[model samples]
Target: MVRKANEDSLRAQAPVFLVADGMGGHARGDAASQTVVRVFEEHIESGAPSTPERILDAIHSSNDAVRDLSTAGDVGTAVSGTTLAGIAFVDAGADSGCQWMVFNVGDSRVYSWEGDRLHQVTVDHSAVQEMVDAGLLDPQHAESHPERNVITRAIGADEYVDADVWLLPAAKHQAFLICSDGLTKELDDDQIARLLASHTGEDGPSTADVLVEAALGNGGHDNVSVVVVRAMIS
Candidate 1:
C-alpha cells in the first residue's frame, strides 16, 4: 500500500455511493476528483432528500467546481476533467420500493448484480466503448485496444456534460457497484462478477478491499476506487 495521495475519490454513504476518477495528470487530477467528492459530501450532509433533480443539481455543481478549479491560476492546470459513476436512491412509485438512480460520465461504471449475474447499468463514454457499441470492435478486442483509455465525455472537459442515467428497481438481495476504470482495466467483466459473487453476503468494505487488491495484483496502472451498495431483506 503506497502512502501517496489518491486522485480517485469515493462517497459511500448509504443510498448514495459514487466514484470519481480524475484526469489531469498530477495534483490537478487530485483537485478534480476532490472537488466532485466535496460537493457530494456537502449535498449528502445537508440532509436533503435524494431526489433525482437534486442529485443532478449536485452533479452540475460539481462540474462547475471542477471547471473553476481548472481555470484557477493556483492549480496550474489549464483543464482538469474526471469520470463520475454513481447510484442514488429515488422514489420508484407510490407504494413501490425505492429505485436505484444510476448515472455516469466517461469510463467509470455502475454494475447491478443479482442472481449469479452482473449487468452494466451505465454505458462508458469512451472510444473503445463506442466502437463496441457500434459493432466495429469485439468486446474482447476492445480490452486491448490502443485507444481504450480515450474517453469521449467527462465533467470539466466541456462546457456542457451529459450523463447517461437509469432508474432501476432496487430489489432485495441485489448489489450495486460503482467503480473507476482502474478495476475494470485490470480485470474483465467475468472476473469482476466472480469476485463479487465470492463476497455476496459480506460487508461493503471487505468486498471493496478484495476488488482493489485484485486490481493491484494485475498491475494497477491507474488510480482505482469502488463503492458497493447492497439492498438487504429485512
Candidate 2:
C-alpha cells in the first residue's frame, strides 16, 4: 500500500485475461507492463476466441515491444522487464477443439479454481521456484526465500521469450485467477481459497475486488493485480 505507483497492468477482455507485473527496481516497469497490454490489445481481437498461433505471436510481440522501451545507452545498463501470466480461449486442432491456453513468462501465475480449491496452472520463472523445483528448497519456504523476487525470465529481459503453456478442456464450468506476485506475497493459498468459496458473483463486490482488498489489507508493499475469468457452458 506504500508504493509510489501501481506498475502492474492487466487486460480483462474476453478471450484474454492477464496480469503483468512490472519489475520494480531500477526498471521502467510501468511502461514495460503497459507495453505488454498494448501489444496484446493490438494483436488479438476482442470478444472472440483466438488461435494458439496468434496468442504466441502476441507474446513474442510483447517481448519485442517491451524490449523497445530500453534502447541505445539503456540497453546494457537499463532494465525494462515484466512478468506475464494469463489464459486465453483458443481453438486447438480439430481433435482438441476449443480450450484454455494458459501461459506464463515470469513469476506471475494462473490458478484454476475448481471445487473451491486452487490449482496452480503455470510454473513460476523465479530463482526460488527453480530451487524448489530442484528440491533444494521446500515449497513452504519459497515465499520467505530471499530470492523470491529474483525472476529468471521476463518479457523484455531477453531477445526471445519462451512462454510456458498448458491446455485445459473447455469444460462446462471453469474459473481461473490470473495474478501478479504482489497478491501471493501478501496472502497464501488457503486465504485465497476461503475467499473464493464465499464469493458470489451476483452479490456484493467481484472476486477480484475482494482479493485485491484482502491483499492490500495484508500490508501490500507491491502493486497488486488480479483477473478472474469464468466460463459456464450450458
- The window of 10 residues in a row where model 1 has the poorest summed lDDT is 69-78
Q: How would you encode candidate 1's per-residue C-alpha lDDT over 1-234 as one tens digit per residue?
A: 332557888888865789999873534778788888889887764432277777888888888888886644544335788889998877655776577789899899999877589898888898998899899999989879999888888888766879888887666677888899889989898999999888754556588788989999998877778887776744
Which residue runs does candidate 2 get wrong by more than 4 Å?
75-77
Q: Give per-residue CA lDDT, model 2, range 1-234, as digits (tens).
A: 889988899999988889999888847899999999999999999988898999999999999999888877675337799999999999998998999999999999999999668998899999998999999999999988888889999999888998998988899999999999999999999999998889856688999999999999999988899998888866
Strongest candidate by lDDT: 2
Clashes of each: 0, 1
Tell me how candidate 1 scores on lDDT: 0.81
RMSD of each: 3.0, 1.2
Count of backbone collisions within predicted model 2: 1
